[model samples]
Target: MKVIGVTAPSTGSGKTSVSLALLSSLNNSVSVKVGPDYIDGSLGSAVSGKPAHNLDRWIQGRDFMRRFRWLSSVYDFAVVEGVMGMYDSGSPVNLSTDYYFRKIGIPYILVIDVSKLAESAYYIAKGFIGRNCIGVVINNFYSEKHLIIVRKAFSDHGVPIIGEIPHAEELKIPERHLGLKTAGEMPDIREKAVHFSQFIDFSFIDKLKDIPLIPEDRKPLLVGGGNIYVAYDNAFNFYYGESLDFLGRIGKLHYFSPLKGEIPENPHMIYLGGGYPELYASKLAEKSHLNHALKTYSDQGVPILAECGGLMYLESTFESKESSLKFPGIFGGSVKMTGKLTLGYTKLNVLKDNLLFRRGEVVYGHEYHYSDIEDSWEKTMQNVLGKGIQGYDGLYSMNTQGSYSHFDLMRYGKRLSGSIAKFMR
Candidate 1:
């Protein structure tokens, strides 16, 4: 199998567009994010018609390579899109695309936006020459003339110009505060994928060599036996596919929408993920029956795992920019939709044995939100990496647990599954 990293000089360089386009160009190829991104898996899955995996170097560390190799072995080719710039390090760990490439000894392709450059684009490619750069893909080129000029300039600098994508308005992906919209929300994603594939040259990709695979020794088991109701809708759609996959392995999953006032019936556990809940605050608040059912479930000691937006929905009220809305009032707190952005990787040390974690066990996660919880409740996890709710996070009451941190269950799959099993017992 072949594994290649796609990176650019900086953000908004069309790395994601290029990666999806390349995946569309290849046969039997899968895509993955190099770090912990909440949206990539949603978008990548829409593009490739398969589930995408995240290989976070900071969270998974050297295990990323092992997991990556095992995942890549299942496909004919694997495309890993880098987060941020090519050489940009992590917030706390020295994990970057360059670091990953050198450590794993894999070749990568550089993507450069050449809409405003000709010969000068070669200078940008020159800096990444010896960093296992097999080739470069020029993005945002105007025409064939623009593509030819940039290709010749890079070829003269001993850099192989693998492909060139044109500047088209229709090829743009919609973006929000959290970056691009989920692939499910994007219109005609397959058509956009086709447009992106037309610009890439697959012949060069075919000539590249293969990388040896690493064996996967850890066997994933179905430790839990219960019915899980996962919140899935436009307002609460942020969840890792691997997490749901593990849930499915252990039990059956039933999907419901809080926006539509649907409640899960007789569920062993409820999962409320993160999304644009603040945007639909009034609608969520209007679902009185759903809110009451959730509260009653929590009151009855049915386990409920709530993330960022999920946590916001369980509060006393949500003060959005437009209006103040009421919530389930499970916890005595209010959430305010703020203009400031809070985003980073976080490590959570469990303060006590809870629904998703054991006492003293550390869980790595990502948090991106524009809302803040007001009242302090029983803190369940201590933040060791990013600033989370003034150093302490997670609100635990009865059998309900909520937090702003989005956990990657694949990192702690067995423990999480076992916890759910123990809870059901």
Candidate 2:
């Protein structure tokens, strides 16, 4: 498939908007985000009508290429939406999108928001122009005269101006503390993307060459797990596409909405991912049936994994400024919504055996949340790199495990599947 990346000079530079437009304009296109962002990928999936995957070199390492090849082989084209700035690194140690672009050998289009600058836009664009940069897309431009000045400035540079997007309020995606709202929340997102597509020149895609696919010999590792229930809704929809794919290979996936107080019957395993649970805290707290069911399942030793918002939902109460609401209470603690945002990549040293990881195993994941556990909690994993609750994470009760760290199945699939297999035995 012909692959192209959409990157920006900085965050909120219209990269997701441009990427969504490209996906809407292309045929049989699939999308991937460069980091552990769940919201942008959801927007891409909505525009493309397919599951959007994530490529985190820090988490997946060299295996990212294998997953990329597998994704390329399935679609006619792929649009990779970059995380943060093109060269912005998570840390001094972690690699960035520029590294991935060079390693994957794909050219990228630099997106620059020219709303605030006139002549300086060119200098900003010029700084980002590199070997892998194919062209530039000027976003949030004022008028014909504004576009003329920026175009004239770039006239000296050999790089072509692929597109000029006007400053339109309709193209903007609503944002909260986490980032852009999910595509489901914004029903007209696809229409907005289509509206944005009219401003862009898609002729560059025609000249892009195809990437050869590599053969995949990987096989399913888990066995004898009958049913795996996953929490999926507006409150709990933060999940990696590959993580769900791996689970589907091992057993049947039954998605239930915790907001509706739904729970699967006789579940072998349960997965509760991260999402805006705090937003729907009261509604979720009203689901006494789900809370009781989850608690009972945990008491029965059913393997359960919860991350971030999921971890909060398992706590006794969701404490907010208005009032405190009840939750599953599996962790016997209260989670209070905080103004302080905890966001970063994390490395975990597993202190105890869990459903998806073994004791002493080092796992790489990320944490992004605005909530903190109020009551003191027991911990199963030690945070070696990023911030954790007093250098500890992974709260476990019987067979249930909850943590703020979110894992990518591309890196943890084999180990996770094996752990599931062992538990089934």
Best by lDDT: 2
| Deviation in Å, model 1, residue 100 alpha carbon | 1.8
* RMSD in Å for all candidates: 2.0, 1.7
- Output the lDDT of residue 321, model 1: 64
lDDT of 1 by residue, 86-205 (tens): 888757777687777777777888899888889888897677666478788899989888888888887776777777888989788889988898875885887888888787777776
lDDT of 2 at 4: 86
* Residue lDDT tens for model 2, 1-425: 88889998899899998999999989999889999999999999999999999888667766888888887657888899888998898574656888788878878999999998988888988878888777999999989999898878887766788888999776789999999998879999899999989988988877888866674655765466668899998999899988988888877899999988887798888999999999999999999988999999999887888999999999998888989898989998888877899988999899887765789999888999987786576788899887777678888888888898898865775555554555567
What are the runs in model 2 whose C-alpha is more than 4 Å off? 217-222, 415-425
* RMSD in angstroms between candidate 1 and the native structure over all alpha carbons: 2.0
